[model samples]
Target chain A: MNTELVLFGVFAVMTLVSAGLVITARSPINSAMALVSTFFFLAGIYVLLWAHTVAVMQVLVYAGAIMVLFLFVIMLLNLGEAAHRGRPTVTRILGGASAFGLLAVLAVTLGRTQALPAQMSAEVQGKFGTMAAIGESIFTTWLLPFEAVSLLLLVAMVGAVVVAKSRI
Target chain B: MVPITYYLLLAAALFCMGMFGVLVRTNALVVFMCVELMLNAVNLTFLAFARMHGALGGGPNAVFGVGHVSAFFVIAVAAAEAAIGLAIVIAVFRSRGSVNVDDIRTMKH
Candidate 1:
């Protein structure tokens, strides 16, 4: 077995398990911590996929910045232990059934797609995940979206401040 | 190399778990965390597709594929979403004194 496959397996398991904890943990702080681990594992998966830039951003943005925001909110709220609600209710049952249905559909669709070749060719692999290559595309053809994202960030920042301010 | 389907399946499972959390959890903050989980699942799909495209000779120089660019936008949007969403959560907690979704029914009153 190759090292790549082993790493993929390990990362995949870590990501999914941590994500499961993020949702199921009764304490929001615990859930936030789990989400942090989830982000880190996801960054590992991104590395395996050869999107090194995206992987770094995943760790920097999701694990570092976004999670800090989440923890801040959780602390600011001072949430107590969520009340121990009973097992699955009707809404939950329906929600789970539908989600599983969606999973089935996605599985079928994914199964149909051809698998990647056993080995990636050299030219295709080279420089694909580098920051330079990503920068080239982002500044060249994808410039408009790049600009738009900045605008979006500005609006989100202003809106967040306005909403979080105590006084209207 | 691992099959692309494995990544897709993993993403699907993560997405479903997130959905289950959103539906079942009463704590608004936990629900928000689930939403982030779902977004990460989507990011996995994007990276998987990007890898596939790159493997298919659609190199990083190819202008047609949107693998990395789409993932970039997704990450940016998710950041914005986390900021605004938490701000709203904080605002709600400030006004309601609690962040439980079931108890914060303003419209019914």
Candidate 2:
């Protein structure tokens, strides 16, 4: 097998397994820890896709800052092992059925698309997914969205502080 | 070389898992984590499509196409969501003394 395929297999397995743990682990802290691992593996997949900038941001934001917030809340709340709820109900069963049904439809649709080229062309392999390319486009063509996102971040920061300040 | 469809399929599976988690888990924090998972899955799809379109060489440096830009925006939004979301979770915990979604039903009454 090719190296790229091998890498994809490894990362895909790791990501899915860790994601499963995130939802299945009893303690919220354990779930958060699982989520950290999931982000790391997902970043690996991003790198395989040649999205180097996104991979870096994934590590920095999701695994680093966001996870810190999750862990902090889990601790502050002092959440014990989630009390075992009763048996799954009809709504739960229906939700599962619908989610799986959606997945099936998505899979079928994707499978029907024309097959993509097996290997990236040299020109794209060289320049695509590079930070320079992304930065150029972000500043030149996508400048407005970039500015808007910064503003949104500012608002979110202020709002979070205000919301969390009441108890402090 | 891996097929782009493989990446898409993987993303779909991950998204399904996240959806399942959201549906089954009653804990608000775990549900939020599932939401994050769903977002990441969507990011994977974006990057996969970016790679595919860039390979077409439609323009100079089209490799880092609009998909990358959109994915970046998604990540930024996710960060903001996490911040605000966790803050809400904390506030809820303080008010109700429980983080379970079932315990926080205010609209029913």
Give Cα distance to truth, residue A6, candidate 1, Å: 1.4
Candidate 1 docking DockQ: 0.65
User: Model 2, range A61-161, lDDT digits (tens) per residue?
Assistant: 99999999999898899898988772588988888888899999999999998656336667657777788888987887788999999999999999999
Model 1 ranges with Cα > 4 A deviation: A86-89, A117-121, B55-65
* Tens-place lDDT digits, model 1, residues A58-166: 9999899998998888777777687666367787789878888888898898888776723556754576777877888888888998999999999999999999999
Cα RMSDs, all models? 2.2, 1.9
Worst ten in a row by lDDT for model 1 chain B: B55-64
Compute fnat per model.
0.69, 0.67
DockQ of each candidate, alpha-carbon based: 0.65, 0.66
Over 4 Å off in model 2, which ranges? A117-121, B55-58, B61-64
Q: Given candidate 2, what's the lDDT at residue B37?
A: 99
Per-candidate Cα lDDT values, in order, are 0.84, 0.88
Tell me the TM-score of each prediction against the true structure.
Answer: 0.92, 0.94
TM-score of 2: 0.94
Clashing pairs in 1: none
